[model samples]
Target: MSEIIGFAGMSHSPFATLLPPARDGEPGGRFLADSTKVGAAVTELRPDAVVVIGPDHFHANFYDQMPPFVLGVEEATGFGDFGSTAGPVPVASGLGWAIRDGLAESGFDVSLSYALTVDHGVVQSYEMATGGAGIPLVPLVLNTAAPPLPSLARCVALGEALGQAIRHAPDPGRVLVVASGGLSHWLPSNDPRDPSVVGERRSSLIHGRQDARAFAAVREPRVRAMAGNPDAPVNADWDRWFLRQLYTRDLGPIVELGHDKLEEEAGSGGHEIRTWLVGHAAAGLPLVWDSYEPVPEWITGMAIGATFPVPA
Candidate 1:
């Protein structure tokens, strides 16, 4: 039988790698130190393949037909935005097919894509976890930015299904399951739905713009601007409380929080935690490592966590 050897979650904040280090005593400084420990564990646990549960920030998915969950079979590649190279990454296709079939048989209507371009979520996670060691990846994309976000309960079920699928893969071997993104974060400027935030001109450019390139031209610049800013808003209290929920192992409070409520409390970026939830459910393993620090420089309530090996 295939086995899940480990699991992890981390902040894919672009600033972690893209921007220079924050000054000592800054929140970013403290958070980066914690991140190094997570990276070190990734090297120590060394898995044959990685299954990354990451969210798309309107980069890969559009509002018209946003999939709550998607599995990239055949292959995967990324835009090379945050200190990662732009190129195709090897994908474990045999395992991908197995997961696609397993989840379907399990009654989860998940989308399977032959071509999916992952952005920072997968890129940063891969870099931090493996340091570009070139491990094969199985990318699972979750839509966190788009409205009508997947419910926390649904995320749990999806994660469980994913865990089952991984075990059933043709050659599960040693798998590193990663839930990439969140603790809690809010970026008022990055909300895609708000025309006012990006200004009416850019909003009009994005309004009903079906061309991916056209939309990206106007959208990506604003995204980069927000990411580069150090004064962006962050809710440290919310992040701390969320971390407490995880440590307590009572996700009841988080589940009770829907997308609307999460947006209000953690900002639009808060929805990224659904990716973390999926990995959490998949491993069904308790947290072995966790660090929470609100880094406004990254505009994310930065955090990371991993699961200990379950006894055979």
Candidate 2:
């Protein structure tokens, strides 16, 4: 039976890679150091395959045809996120299919993509944790960007299913599981085109396509600013609270936290924690190491941690 030899989490911010922290041991600086450590851990374990549980930005899914979850079934490449490093990566096709089938059988309505181009959320983990070697990868994409998001309980279920799938794999190899995305940070979330918005705008759009285009034109600048600002807002208090709850690993309160609560407290970007939840559940052990720092420069609540199995 296959085994999850290692599990880890890390920030996937493009600024974490493209820009250095203003000072030594700052958020970005620590991110680099910890990422190197994760990469070293990967080298040490030498897992036969790596499964990355991560989310996509607006790049992969837009307002139209958003999928809650997707599994990449083909050899995937990175989009070189925000000028960060990227390249083609190998795919563990057999294992990917196994997990896909397993998830479907287990009641997960996951979308499958034969030709998917992963962005920084998935790529940064490989670049930082594996030194971008030819280790085959399976990308499990989450819909953290769009609204009516999946529940935290659902995320935990997915993680449990993932662990079971890995365990039942035909080839028993030391597999590395990396959950990439958040601690806490807010970005541009509101858009006129959002499905949640309704009434007058919906009526206007129904009347004329040009009116809809005009509405988007008005709303685009704020969203663009949210993405472009290097020193976007960071909620350190919320980040700390989240880390405390995650440390418990019960996932009860977390499961109940809807997107509004997350946005109100942890910020919209905090939704990325869904990725971390997957890894936490799969690790099947109390975390051994964890760290958090609010890095406004990277515009994120930069965090990293890992879980090691207890000794027999």
In model 1, where is the ten-residue run with the lowest total lDDT? 200-209
On residues 173-280, what C-alpha lDDT tens digit does candidate 1 reach at each position?
888888788756665444456566456444533352355455666655766686656677888898777766665445668889877788788887888989878888
What does candidate 2's lDDT look like per residue over 259-311, in tens digits?
A: 67877777778889999888778766556766677777777888877775322
Please list the residue runs of candidate 1 whose C-alpha ends up more than 4 Å from where it truly belongs after superposition. Answer: 22-27, 188-214, 227-231, 248-250, 309-312
Identify the candidate with maximal lDDT: 1
| Pairs of residues at least 3 apart in sequence or in different chains that clash in candidate 1 | none
On TM-score, the candidate that comes out on top is 1
